[model samples]
Target chain A: MGNRVIKMSTLYLTEQGSILHKTQRRLVIIKNKKIIQEIPIFKIDRILIFGNIQISTQALSFILDSGIICSFFSSQGKFKGSLRPVESGNVFLRIAQYERYLDKEFRVEISKTIVYAKINNEIKFLENYSKTNFKEIIEELKKNINNLKDKNSISSIMGIEGHSTSLYFKGLSLILKNKFLFEKREYHPPKDPANALLSFGYSLITNEIFSLLSGIGFDPYIGFFHELTYNRPSLALDIVEEFRTPVVDKMIVTLINKNIIKEEDFQREENSIYLNNIAKKAFLTHYEKRIQNYREIIKVQCHKLMDSVLNKKIYEPYLED
Target chain B: MGNRVIKMSTLYLTEQGSILHKTQRRLVIIKNKKIIQEIPIFKIDRILIFGNIQISTQALSFILDSGIICSFFSSQGKFKGSLRPVESGNVFLRIAQYERYLDKEFRVEISKTIVYAKINNEIKFLENYSKTNFKEIIEELKKNINNLKDKNSISSIMGIEGHSTSLYFKGLSLILKNKFLFEKREYHPPKDPANALLSFGYSLITNEIFSLLSGIGFDPYIGFFHELTYNRPSLALDIVEEFRTPVVDKMIVTLINKNIIKEEDFQREENSIYLNNIAKKAFLTHYEKRIQNYREIIKVQCHKLMDSVLNKKIYEPYLED
Candidate 1:
């Protein structure tokens, strides 16, 4: 089975002859305003078109034919209409969606969140190590976990992770050398570095959701928690909520910690920052690998949950590590 | 301003010898399948359409031209899609909508609840006289505001009105006979009333709402409290809420007091009750007259807290005797 990743990145259409025109159905790409590449309406699920593009009605007919969708923003940065096909969203599909949202049934939730916290802690340890020879940090933390002479309060454990996330984010900005800045939460359609990581992480989470839904033969578009709006895929939004803090953040932290991608990885545009080609490629490649490298155990478990969804059994998603 | 109502006993038709079609740019109304009427669209404000209707491409073109709207539903049912020329709602509109909901800038914020205990006392005295031997009840109950003076407790006052409302509903139902069995404060929706008189009373409330929204220059569709689902005119729902215990309930009491519309005015159909033409006309005519008659000038003063809604001025609806 193909890797279900919510995270999407553009490869800059290395095929210079290819122009990704967001046709209604499939990725009816054009080059020099002529058809160069055409991913059939049924083949592709999303069309992330960038820059100026012209749309045709025939493409729309295809989009309407396939139960796929694409949301667009014009070059002038105004939201264009969404290309979506209507669906009854079936009874069982809705049940699974509700399961994914309600506590108890969404299993992918906690693992992803915990991974994020652990990565943030590691980042903090690394940053502090750079500033001082702090060799006792992780060792002491490990020892403390092992020696459960007294059970520490959950808040204290969470407090430690929270401090680590803050420390990691601050240290990351310093290492990026003015290339990035962290921001407050609620960053979608990412406004900055923190938001970018959040959106990217969120995308990865959505991939899991899609995979889970697909396993149950359900369309991952209809959703609750997030309302079904005109252009938004409410299901995608629903799946991404718990993962925004974990996977994407961890990936970014890893890249920064290992010094694989440096401060020079991006360039500042007028009101936004653009990832340089090399950085974008490296990020996409790493993203693909991270989702790909997941152990078969997780997949097996997800399949079990999917089975439960299909057979109408309940499976709860993890909320914390 | 034209009456919020465009009344025609029978559906209106265009000069083209077709049935009435309200193909207005902003409001494309189609009744019994014919394009008869058209009006300029509002400046992309809120769209409000009712009745079962269909649309033509030309009417949609007008909507596109005016950038107003052409959202329609299956006739007498729910919203299906946008037809002809409907401009999709913008972000500001969405934000404003969310603000009205989440921020509680709505009429049902509980602050608007009033307790005119003095006036209610008088009404109660009169009702008691007729119900429990007028001469004896009048002697037992004290007259004037002497007893109520200086004993100011908001809850106590509100409680008095609440109790009076119960008595009023019970007494009115008895006069209307076993034709209607109201379950205290149950809401009506097409069905549920025991007889036609109750249904007529409910319908009378709807008509009053339509008029009230018109008189205030407010859109009768985009209101708070009740949710504005795609097809349901939520504004009508909101206006109807406050008037249930006051207007309709009051009118029913008056009718019983005067013996105007009688128990014979009702007829049973299976499990439900409906009014015949005579009863309908009596109710409608009386409703119109009563709405026009203003007795007391009771106002809802929202203290300094509610001043932000409509300045320092209080809300005062015409309470007819």
Candidate 2:
């Protein structure tokens, strides 16, 4: 849909940062950059620090003053604390908003958030699917994609596609290593050892999707169908669909194959699964490195994609089975 | 967190002029605030509209001159394209960096991100949980929270006494109406209609979380436990957990009990239930308005609780059965 810029291979920073998402921007400060100690860029929204980073009150004050999000982590990549800006620092408002959503307007807003998110996501996915396997998938559009093209309306196209895509997502377990399957649908508090991994992984993957969408400057929550309830990041889910296979599932496979994460990393008791501290620590190492190592592809000389999308460059998303 | 200032909500207008997203700054926009174009800022990344809320050639040239991210979104909130200022647009370089993560160098960096995000989100959630229920949920911590003279390690005391807090979240379904049975570890492709509601509702709630997290300057993607992966937003989930029950679930009960929504809205097919388009749209309209509606409370001002937290003010969270 836009100009194409693909960064095929690059080294990602092993450290991590917070997910500063917005309708128009994603602000991320590399821990390695130590921007916190440097002159404050009050414009940057999220500052992510990892691997034994230290900070001063001045930096913290700057973050607060600028209303930037400052998330911290240990050298081992454990999440530490957040320095939320003032006014936004009110956690009680979050609770009250939560209360209101539950009491006054749950279904109307919550459902719409999900619905719109489904539509936005499915539409993007189908368009990509169409371009990627244009010949093959398009042929099955009538059945697998619920005949989306046949619909004269965009809403109909999105609705039909959303249902079909979800079905595909639900069936992903069959293709994945069963140990990695939390089935979310089948989770009885997960009598299996991988339950915690799945839960954590899904949540992780969803957030990553949110960051990417925001970085690309899309609304992370103003979804079409998903209700716009207080503090819900529907936009994150809206974009996560296409990447789940590549970011979460593929990483799971790689983690398992490399012994970066083991069955022992997960614990099961009475049908519920949890990640032991050690297992979590081990898995976290590999996961952190993977994202920092991630890089996008781009044309050698073209801001053309970024500057003028009038020519319409195609971007095929990364998909991993 | 810091002090919050009250500002009137402004209607968003994209493509009116140059848009700026300063790093480390929370969601505050230093817009020329004089412009007014009702272009919903839903998915737009600070649209610098020199002409027709669009990235015309002149605008692209200016962005290229400035070396900023010129992000674009469709009016319907779809992410359309981006423009990197040539003066500073090294998107090609950024892509090269992304590709490096594909190499072995990526493993360690990626894994670290996952570990830290997990810790951060867990801590944030726990901190919130302890703040309100520390005394009641865990009697041992009561002395520290309730007693102003207790200069002891509030977190440590809460940690030891707040053991049952986990049961509160994990076992919430037990307290709800039988219409929604959150059984022991149910896998969440979420088969039950209630489960579907839970999933969808949680997503919306998380968006609200994103708004606050971003407004406060936290990177939604550089999460602690959630892996940094292409196309995922780990930070969004981290923020979502803080309000799941208080917002989405509560709203769900209200909808069902108040008869605002009916069984007819949900269509059960092949054992899976979904909301029809009409129902879904109706839900979003209401949800948006609800989010727009704000309440006043002690220690909390106009914005929701999440904002208060970001602003760094002391506020308490409340829960409803």
lDDT of 1 by residue, B1-321 (tens): 134233211111112212222244444444445433443445232232222222332332333344332332221212333222111312223223333433442434322332233234435535643555343333333232233333354344444445545554454455443544554544333343433344455554454443333223223344444444433445455445444544555676566556676656656566555555465556655654554331111112111212323342343432224
Q: In lDDT terms, which candidate is top?
A: 1
Docking class of 2: incorrect
- Among all windows of 10 consecutive residues in model 2 chain A, the one with the lowest summed lDDT is A1-10
- TM-score to true structure, per model: 0.37, 0.32
The Cα local distance difference test for each model comes to 0.41, 0.38
DockQ-derived CAPRI band for the predicted complex in model 1? incorrect
- In model 2, the Cα lDDT at residue A275 comes to 68
Per-model DockQ: 0.03, 0.01
Candidate 1's residue-wise lDDT over A1-321, tens digit each?
123222232212233224344554446557676776555444444443223343332343344345444334322222333333332224343334444444332323332333333543444445443544234444444443333223233344445445544544554454442444554433434556545544544554454454345334443444433443543545444445434433455677677667667666656566554455566557656765664444232345445445555564543433333
Badly placed stretches (over 4 Å) of model 1 are A1-27, A73-81, A91-161, A167-321, B1-321
